[model samples]
Target: MTTKRKPELVAYTVTGEGEKAYWTRIGSAWAHKDGEGFNLDLAALPVNGRIVLMQPKPEGDAA
Candidate 1:
């Protein structure tokens, strides 16, 4: 049997640089059982932006 786990990180499409950067949520990633790699699920792929992985924000904390 296989169990589903919550995503360990959130994926974002980043544009610009430094303080003027923009981050948009684009996907999520889950670690493999062996911790060797991750599986990424993206809702929208970017054509000219960088893809970044970050830890998800805590519940109810909107920045």
Candidate 2:
């Protein structure tokens, strides 16, 4: 049996730039067993924004 682990990266829809930039949580990604690709699950797809992948923050830490 296989167990699911927490996502290593968080996906976001980004708009604007610099201090004015906005980030919206859109999905999560899990690396494949072979480490050659990732499995992405998105709640919504953006039409006019860019998708950015970043590491998840530690619990209780906000930046």
Candidate 3:
């Protein structure tokens, strides 16, 4: 069966190899919304990455 792609909440970190120690959110994929949406903490990753929110599986059998 084919699988569908969904959003997910994730945390990313940049890897500048100790050269560039800084990271900023790229693009306008998401915006600040209090404490209800994705709170990306790129202090660790130090690189631009995505923090998605994966869709929940359909209720019923655990495929």
- Show the lowest summed lDDT stretch of 10 residues, model 2: 1-10
lDDT by residue for model 3 (1-63), tens:
121332233233333546664333321223235646643323233334533233334569452
Candidate 3: residue 27 Cα off by (Å): 26
lDDT per model, in order?
0.85, 0.86, 0.35
**Model 2 agreement with the true structure over 1-63: per-residue lDDT tens digits:** 133788879899988999998899998998888999988888988888689999999889974
The TM-score values for the models, in the order shown, are 0.82, 0.86, 0.18
Tell me the RMSD of model 1 versus the true structure: 2.9
2 against 3, candidate with superior lDDT = 2
lDDT score of residue 36 within candidate 1: 98
Cα lDDT, model 2, residue 25: 92
Top model by TM-score, which number?
A: 2
Model 3 scores worst on lDDT over the 10 consecutive residues at: 1-10
Task: Give me the overall lDDT of model 3.
Answer: 0.35
